[model samples]
Target: MANETKKSQKILIVGGGTAGWMAANLFAVHWPDMEICLLESSDIGIIGVGEGSTPHLKFFFDEVGIEESEWMPRCNATYKNGISFVDWSAIPGFNHYFHPFPAQTDDIFTVPAFFSSINARMQGHNANAHPDHYFLETYITAKHCGPIPTENFPFGVAYGYHFDSGLLGQYLAEKAISRGVKRVIGTVTEVILNPRGELASVRLDDDSFLAADFFVDCSGFKSLLLQGALKTRYTSFKENLFNNAAVVMPTPMYGIIPPETKSTALSHGWAWKIPLTTRYGNGYVYSADYITPEQAEMELRQHLGLLESDVTARHLQMKVGRVEKHWEKNCVAVGLAQGFIEPLEATALALSFNTLSAFIKCYEKGGYSNQFEDAFNNEINARFDGVRDYIVCHYKVNQRRDTPYWKDNAANTHVSETLAQIIHFWHRGGDFAKNLYMNNLVGSYQPKSWACLLAGYGVFPPLRSDEHNAPAPSLPDMVQLGDFIRRCGLNFSAHNQLLDHIHRRPA
Candidate 1:
C-alpha cells in the first residue's frame, strides 16, 4: 500500500448545524484538494440556543482567515473574556469569582503568586487566595471591558465569543461554500454499511444513495452513521454528572454588557446567563430525576423575574458521554453524534476542532490508513474524561447543602482515581503541581486551571487559631496586585463600545 499512488479523499458530512459547518470548513482549510461535501438535513434544527467557546475558537477563526468583524456582527456575537461563577461557594467573600482564559502576562508573575497563595491558605496560613484579583481578565471583566488590549498595552489576552448558534451555523455555511465545499440538503433515512462494518453510503428519503471515500457523522445525537450504522458502544458519564435537561429563555438586553458568561449556582443545577447584542440568553441546567421540566422552567422564569411574563422556554435533553471510539472504522463522529459532556465549560466547538485536527494529523500520518485509529480514540476519550473531571470537581467542591443533588454529588465516590489523587494532594499543600505533572495526572487542564477552579470555590481547610492571626508577609499583597490589575485595565475599551465598534464596521 505504501507504493500505491495517492488519491484525493472524498468526505461526506451528514448534518448542517454549527458542528457540521465547522467540520466542513476545517476540512476545506486543511485539505484544499480533498472533495468535501456537507450533506445536511433541513428538518433538523440547531441544538443550543446561544453558544460560548474556549480560546481555541479564536485560533480556529484565525486559521480559517475569518476576522472578528466578518462574523461577530452577523451572529449577534460578543466578546467573552471568561466565565464568572457566582454563588457556587457559600463562603463569604468567596461567593463569586471570574475564571479568566489564559493570558500572555499571566505566567510572568501572577500565576506563581496565585498558586503560592493557594498553597499558603491550604497550609493554615492567613492568605488571600480568591481568584478574582489574581488574573488581569478578572479586572477587565469586573469593569465591563473587552478583552482586546489597547495599543499601549504590551501583553495579550486570550478570549472567546458568545454568539447565536443558529446564525453562526449559517455564517459558517456560507463561508464553507465560498471555499469550495459543496452543500447537499437531504434527510438521511438509512445508512448503508459494507460487510466490513464500515460506512459505504447513506440512503436519503428520496431513495437516493450518496457514497464517499470517508464519512463524518454530524447528525446530532442520533449518530446516524457512526453509532447507528457501526453500532459503536456509547459511554454515559451519569455516574458523576446528573444534570440531564436544560430549559432556555431569552431576557431583554440593556445597560452595560459584560464581556463574559455568567454561571450562577441553582438548586438543582446551575443557571447560565449569556449576553448577545440582540438579547440575553438564559438557561437552567437541572436533573430531571430531581425536578420536572415544568418546574425547572418555572424556576428559571422566577430567576429571571419573568414569572408573570408569557415568555416561552425550550427544553432540551442532554445525553452526556462519548462513544467507545470516535473513529471506529472509515467513519468518524463529530459534535452531538460523537458524544457530549454537557456545556459546563462551553467546549463543544473546541472539542470538535480538536478532534478533526487530531484525526487529520493521525490519519495523514498513517497515509489515511487505520494505523493510528486506536491512538486517536484513546487521546480524545482521555480529553473528554479530563474535562469531565474538571466539571465534576465544581459540583464536588461546591459549598451548597440545600439540595440532595448537591449533597449526593459531594458524597458520591464515583470519581476517577486520578481526580481523587489530585484532591488528596491538594489539601496537604505540598508540591501538588509538580506531582500532577510528574505523575501524568494533568490531562487537558494545567495546574493553574485546577488551582483556579478549586481555589475559586474556597477549597482550603478552615483557618486555625494561630493561622487566623498569621503575619501579613506570608499573604499575597492584594493592595499592590489590585493596583497593577486596575492600572492595566485602563487600556481595554468598554465591552459595549467594543461590540458597537464591530457592529458599526462594514461586514
Candidate 2:
C-alpha cells in the first residue's frame, strides 16, 4: 500500500457553468495541494437556464462542504421533492400524477400496489381508486411550500433544489478560489497536444499557454476540449431517443409556485415549469423536425400564460449519447461536453455530479490509472444508458396520439434494444423484482428507476396483488388521497415572498 511519490498533478478545466464550477470545486476540495486551475471564456455564455435538479445534489453539497444556507440564498435555491406530470398521455380524462424521490417504509414496499390501484382507476376497473394518497408528492404540491416532511427516515427524506445555475457557478468559483484553485479568465484559442496522443496544454486568447497533467471538459455543447482537441468521435443517440430541440425561457411566477417541477406534455413536445426561489424556469422540448423553435416557444408562452421577453426564448439542440471513451490519454469530459438526454426529468446536473465523482474516486485511489479509467467509463455508460432506457420508456408507455408530433414520433420512434425488452417485459406483467444487468442499473443499489420512469409514465403491474401477498383492501379515493397529501405538508410561497427571502439572505 505504498504511495507512489504522488505527482503534484495540474488539472485544467474548460468552460464555466454548473458543470465547470462543480468540477473545479470538487477538485479543489479533495486535492487542495494539486494545481487545479479553471479556464473560462468571459465572452462565451453558458446555458445556465437549467434551474431544476435531482435530490442527489444534497450529496454533492456534502462532498464540496457547501452549507445550504450560504449557497442557497445566493443561488435562488428552492427545495424540490419530485416532479409532477400532466397530459403526458394526452388522454381526455383527468390523468395527472407525480414521481416522488426515494421513499421507503420499514413495514412494507407498497409501490406496486400504489401504481396498480391508480392504473385500475384509470382503466375504470375500480370504482374507488385511491392509489397515491399516502405519497409525499401529492401532499407537497398541494401545500406549495417545501418544509422537510417528518417522515420515518431520520437522516432526512430525499430532496433536490431549484436554483439559479449562473449564481451557482459564481458561488462555486469563489469557493474554489478560496480553496487555492487558480481561475484563468480567457477563451481557449488553441489546444496543444503531445506526440503520445495526449493533450499537453491549451492556449488562451491572451496568447498564454496553460499546461496541465489532466484536462476536464465542461464546454457545454461545443465539447471544445475532449471532442474538438482530443477528436473523440461522438456517438449518436438520435435513433434511440427522440425530441432534440428545446426552447427555454425564465419567466415570473403566475401564482403560488409548487415545490415540484411540472412537465406537461403538449401537442408537439413537452413543457417544463421549474420554480426557483425567485422566478419560474419554463421550456418546451420538441422535435425541431416536427415543430419550429418559434412555434415551440409560442406554445411554452401559452402554457405559462405569458409573452416573450429578453430572457423569454433560448433554443438548445442535443443528441442523446456520450463519447465512446470519456477518458482517453489524459483528458476527461464532464457535463454537456460528455452528453445530454433531453430533460424529461431533471437529471442533467445529477449526471454531471456522478461523472465527476467517478473521476475523483479514480484519481484519489491512484492518479490516472487505467483501472480507474475503465471503471469510470463503465459507470458513466451505465448511468447514461439506464437514463436513456427510462426516458425512452416515457415515450413508449404514453397513450397520447393527439398531434402528428406525438403520434408519428411515438409510433415511429426506434426504441433501443433495452427499452424494447423492458416494454415487452412490462406488457407481459413483469415485476421490477428481477435484476437489471444493463450498464446503467439505476444508481448503486437504489430503485430510482422504478420510482421515476415506471411510476411517472404510469406503467403498472398487471396484477394489483403482486405488491403484497395478502388480499388487497379497498384504497381511498383520488380526491381524498389528494386531500390527505395536502394535510401532511409540502407547500410553496408566493413569488414575491420567495424572491424577498432570496434577496435578504447572504451567500
Candidate 3:
C-alpha cells in the first residue's frame, strides 16, 4: 500500500456564469500558483436573473480586491437595504412590511425593547403604532435612505447590492483571468471518469481532453459533472416549496430606484421587483401545479400594468432541491448546479459564496478526508434545508385566503419538523435570542429575520394568562428613537443620490 497524499494543484471549472467565474476567481486569489482553468461555451446563455444579494457579498469583493467603485457602476449596481414584502398577509389594506438589515446602532438591546414595545401595543396596552417606530434600522429604510457607511458608524449600515448578473460574471472573469486563471471557450461534450470512479478529465467539444486533480461543477442546473458523472442523487423540496417556474422581464424605471427589493405577494406565488440604475428587474415565481407559465406571465403583466403583447417574457424552470452530496468524489457543485430555491430573499449569491468558502476551508486542511467530507456535507445540507424552511415560513404564515394558491399554502404546505419545532418554541415565547444563537440554522436569515416575517404576517402564539406584558416605550423614549433615526438618516444619503455618487466617482 502506498502511504502518500495527493494535493490538488490542477483544477478545472466547468461552466462560466456567476458561479463559475466566482469559483475561478476565489480559487485563483487564494491559490495563485495553482493552475486554474475555466471552460465555458459562448453559445450557452446564463440564467442571469439572480441580481440581488446579501451583505456577505461584501466579503467576497474585499477578498478578491474588487472595490465597490470599480464594480458598482460597471454592473449597474445599486445598494440594497433589505426586502419589503407587500400584501403577504390576509389582512386587507395592509400595505407592506420590511425585513431591514439587522439594526446597526449603539443600542444593541434596542431590538428586544422594540419587540416588547410592539408586543405590548399589539396587546392593546397602547395606541397602535407600526413596528418600525421603535427600530432605527427599519425606520431608516422607511425613510428611503441608503445604508451608507459613516466614520463613526462604520458597521452601522447593513447592505448588499442589486447588479446585472451577466455583467458581474464578466467583471469577475476579467479579475480571475488577471489573477492567472486560464479561460477556455469550449463546451464540455463529455465527462470522463477514472477507473476508481472519480472525475479524471473532461472532453471539450474541440476533441481535447483536459485532466485535473479536482473539478467544480458550475454547469448550472445541468449538474453535468457531479450528477451526470458521479451519479449523485437529488432530494427535492417540491412538497414544501411550490414555486418551480419563474417568468422574468425587464421594465423601464419609472422613478427613483429604491434601496430595498420589493416582493409583492400575488394570487399564485409572488412577484419580485429589483431596481437597477437603468431598469427594474421583474419576475413572477409560481408553481406549475397551480398555474401554467402562460397564466403566470399574464398575471405578471397585469401586475406591471403591461398588455399581454407588450412584454416578451422569459420563462425559467427551477429545480427546487439540492444534490444529495455537494462534495462527491473529487467534484463539488456550486450555484444552481448544487440546488436552487426561489429567489424569495436574494440568497443565490450568498449560497454560492458560502459553499465555495466552505470547500476552500476543507481543501486547506489536508484535502479530501472522510472526516472533512462528512463535516462539509453536513454543514452544506443544513444550510440548504434551513434556507428552504425559511422560505417556506413566508408562505405558511400568510393570512391570505383569496386564491387557491394562498389557501393551499396556508392549509396544506409541507412543514419540516425542524421548522415546526422552531415555530413551536417561538410561539411559546421561548428564548428567541438564545435559539437563534444556538441553532444558527442558516447563514442569511437569523432570529431577527424570522421575527420580521412571523410578526409581519400577524402570526403569533397565544399569550399565556400569567404573561406580564410590559408597557410600551414611553413617549419620550419614542421621541428619542425618532430623533436618533432622523440623525442617522441625515448621515445616509438618498438611494438615488448614492448611485449617482458612485457613478460619478473616479474608478
Candidate 4:
C-alpha cells in the first residue's frame, strides 16, 4: 500500500495587497515552475498606513530582484536609519532617545558596560555624554541626511525604507505578473472546505470556483480561508497592547525629510511620523477606552499643528491580535490575516514576509508533514509572542503620570513571564546577550533594542562589582568617537540630494 498524502502544486493566494503580492513574487521567484495564482477584489480598499519598515525588507527586495531605483521613485520612498522616540518617559528633556540599527564596530561593549560608561560620563557633567555618541548611525542620520547607500555598512550604518504601502503592493504585483504569476480580480463570496477540515477552494462573486492544492490567506483581517473556512480562533493581545484604534493622515513635508521615523508619545498613545519623498505618513494610535475616534482626530490635528479642515483623517479600528495558528492543514494566513499589533515598530510587513519565507522553506524540505506543521506553528507563535512582549516593554517601563491612559498603562500593563524574567535578569546586572527571550532567530527588536527602552525609562540594573569598578572609556576615546561621527555626517551627501541622484540615473 502506498501513502495517500497530498502534495501542494497549484497555490491559490487570496488577497491582493502587499502581503499577497509579496507571497506571489517570492513563490514565483524561488519556484518558477510552480503555478501561483493571486486573487484580489477591485472593490476592496487596502489599509495602506504601514509606511515604515525594518531592515529585513531589504532582504525581501533583493530576493525578488527589486531595485531601489525601480521602487523608490515609484513609491515616493525615503531612506530610514532607525526610529527616534520622544517623550516616552516623563523626564522632560531627558526623555528623547534613538533606537538605532546595530553599530558597525568590533569594539561594541556589552549593555552593562555601555550603560556604565554613559553613567560615569554623565556624572562628570559632560554635555556630550549621551547614548547617541556611542552609535555611528546617529551621525549618519544627523549629517548624511539618511542611511548609507551600501547594504553592507562597514561604518555600522543599517537602514530600511519608509514608502507608500499601496504603491509597494502595486509594484510587487507588476513584478510578480512579469514573473508569470496569474492574477484574478474578484471578491470571494464563499470558502469551501473539505471533509478533513482543509481548504478545498474559494468561490468568487461570479459564482465560479477556484481550486488549488494549497491556499494562502492574505485576505487582510478577515482571515477568509484560515479563520473563515478552517475556523481558527484568534488570540487577542488587547490586554497586553491597549491601543485598539488609529486615525491616519498625510501632511505635506514642512522641511527636509529626516532619515529616521519619529514616534512621539501622546497622552493616550503615540503618533508616528514617517517622512516620504513628497508627504509625511502620520497616524495617532490610541486606546478607544481612553478616547474616541473623533477625539483622536482632534488630538492628532492639534499634534500636527493643523486645523480640522487642514487634512482629512481616516479612522481605523485596529485588531490587536494573531490567529490561534498561522498555518492549519493546507491553509496558511499571512499579513493582517495572520495578526496585527499596531504600527509601533512597523512589524506588519516584516511579519508577513517571515511567514511566507518560512512556509516555503518548510514545504520544500519536509513536504508539510504533521511534524513540520507543528514546527511551523511553534516558530510563528514564538515570533508573534516575542513581538508582543517587546511592544509591551515600551509601555511597561514608562514613568509618565500626565494622563489617565499613561497612568493606567504605567500601573496596569501586563507583562508576560518571559518578559518578566528578562527584566528580572536585567535588574540583577545580567548580560542581555545571554537572554534567549531578548533575542530570536527571526525578528527585528533585539536585545539592543530592549536596552534602549530600558535605558530610556531609567531602568538600569544594579552595577556588578566588576562593572562598577571597571575603567570607563577615556575622555580622549570619547572625543575621537564624536569626531568620527561629525566627520561621517559632514562627508555624506544630504538625503534629498541622494534621492535626486538616484532619480536622475537611468533605470
Per-residue lDDT of model 3, residues 173-278, tens digit only: 9989989999999888888988988989988888999998889999999999998989999999989988899999999985778888999999899999999888
Q: State the C-alpha lDDT per candidate.
A: 0.87, 0.71, 0.80, 0.78
Flag regions of model 4 displaced more than 4 Å.
1-8, 106-130, 149-153, 368-371, 430-444, 460-476, 487-491
* Candidates ranked, most accurate by lDDT first: 1, 3, 4, 2
Clashes of each: 0, 10, 0, 1
lDDT of 1: 0.87
Evaluated against the true structure, the overall lDDT of model 2 is 0.71
> Model 3 — TM-score against the truth?
0.92
Residue-level lDDT tens digits of model 2 in 316-358: 8866788877877678898898988878878889899999898
- Give a tens-digit lDDT track for model 1, residues 282-387: 9999999999999999889989999999988999999998998999888889988998887888988888888988988987888877788999999999988898
Looking at model 3, residue 125 earns an lDDT score of 46
Error of 3 at 478 (Å): 2.7
TM-score preference between candidates 2 and 4, better one:
4
Reference-based TM-score, model 1: 0.97
Model 4 score (lDDT): 0.78
lDDT of 3: 0.80
Model 3: weakest 10-residue lDDT segment is 1-10
RMSD of each: 1.7, 4.5, 3.0, 3.7
